[model samples]
Target: MTSKITLFQHGTGAMIVPGLFDGTIDIQELLTHGDTGIGSGDGLDGESIINNGTPLLIRGDGSVTIADDHFTVPFVNAHFAAYSTINNIQINDFQSLGNYIFKHHQYQNILFSVKLHGQFEWVKTRSVFKQSKPYPSLVATAKSEKRFESQHLSGTVIAYYYPDAFSKFAVGGFHAHFISDDQSIGGHLMNFSGFNGDLGIQKFKKLDLELPIDNADYLNHDFKNDDIEAAINQAERES
Candidate 1:
């Protein structure tokens, strides 16, 4: 199959009402679209990862668990990652690794899927705790975020390189989530070092976005001119 990334709902949509959990799409429906991707569970419970064909949930305490196929998610980005190459490369740190990938990829207006599997000196990650009714906004949740760090471990980093032109609707640059080989720990990647493994690269030429028309929170909410960019940066990146 040709490489394509299907983004279900915009990142901005989640910011409008941070914990909107009444989404219609379930895990079974999601799996039909793609096998490898990342998303969040209902109530922003934890970091959801669809690796191969299994769905795993990474909690705030850095614990891994199997996700129920019937569980719902408000946002998801996935694809049947068909890579062209899985090359071995030496990477010093996170920024250098991104630079190295960019060197091979010259296009600035296209989307790309990436998977790096190997050993690392250190890796830092974060996950969202489940929220209750009358949930807080995304920015507020980011302000008091808790982070987890692992030293000298083997893992895989699943990521996407989204173009800047779609900044408002999605993650502008690289958005990544990580899981260890043991399946004991994982979350949204904040910082990491040493990419000593096979790096899979797949360039995507088409992007299909699915909006939540059945969900009222998504339909009646105001997504225009929101601080989605800032909130995403704050929640997903290191301070």
Candidate 2:
């Protein structure tokens, strides 16, 4: 029998929408769930990309650095599985990539992971500045985010696809992050002009979600009062 692929998640996007930026799950413990994934640091410090076993922190200034093992993460999606390489195709932009995946993959209701590696004609990204006590909602934080763009950059794009049914727990659609080959630039991917590379995809049959059961903020927050869908659409998508 074939083994089922599992997607391990540390926290929910819903929690972040309400500004629950503190997390008890450390990078050291998160890595054990999967060697490859994407997430953010405590207080929304930066965008995190876990390529293989290395966790990289992309700061608001578009600076990239290795994340400390002790650094805590408020939200993360990770999985351990080998990707099946799809034929190289011309990707004009981020939307095109999404269309391609939807048209070819035929797993709309399922969760999957995508990895693209090669040269990009141009790439656009953004990262949130670290927040302090009495954190602001993600939508508010995104308004003051730092945006970066580069031309002819070589790097990898790590992303996850969570169907609409999973929106309450995670981003409803494609949520992606980028990292250059030299590890100099990367963040929450806003868009890309051109992509010439290999596409690899893996579909997960099961989801292993770990919530912050002991977190007062998570337990106390009244999520029903918030427009989670609207907030996520505004804060996470290209504006």
Candidate 3:
């Protein structure tokens, strides 16, 4: 059975969200805590894995706060939470991830901003899905706000140039939620694209990415340069 695994680990991570250009692949098989994940054996050392493609999640209600000093030195507090749905499903991968790079865009006028620090967690369960199994949340809880309209820079189409083979991409956690206190509203595209969904109830229907979400606007073009991917990978290894 394909089950969703909740990955949660509270270790001191690098402060700044490092940049992963592309082609940057690191195959480090981590030795997870023997006590965590499904089919528990030893004691719960606080970890677990359900499957390969587990549910990536990120959700919360209220300003999330934490302190960390790792990764990107001087970037302080590695925290973030971005949320969004995909294929009628919401992904929370970044929920437990620390420090995320966020970009904001303007439609009417070509403008942008950026946010660095980020944090996240996942909703334990929705009232309707009460019987649902819980997943490990790297970070949950979103800044208090009504999700009807704009959830930070969410809803707005933030595009990115993924590797050529990307049939589709997913970016969850708060980069999808809009909790970056450092976000400036315009900047560079990050390593990924936040989750896309139909939250707007206009036209009385869910806003699917396949359908038009906004007016004629700036186009987000993907630079299919293998060199870009190669550069990203080279940088990661050297760093």
- Candidate 3 per-residue lDDT, tens place, 171-222, comes to 2111222222232221111222343332211010111111112212102222
Instruction: Provide the clash count, candidate 1.
Output: 0
Candidate 2 worst ten-residue window by lDDT:
1-10
Query: Which 10 consecutive residues of model 3 have the lowest summed lDDT?
Result: 124-133
Q: Candidate 3: what lDDT?
A: 0.19
- Cα error, residue 185 of model 3, in Å, equals 14
What is the descending lDDT order?
2, 1, 3
Model 1 — TM-score against the truth? 0.91
For all predicted structures, in order, the TM-scores are 0.91, 0.96, 0.18
C-alpha lDDT values of all predictions: 0.75, 0.89, 0.19
Query: Largest lDDT belongs to which candidate?
Result: 2
User: Per-residue CA lDDT of candidate 2, range 1-239, in tens?
Assistant: 12339888888888998899996689888888888889998999999999988999998888888999899999998877589986566799999998988888798999999999998999998998899989999999998899988999899999999989988879999999999998878999999978998999999988898999999989899888888888989999887
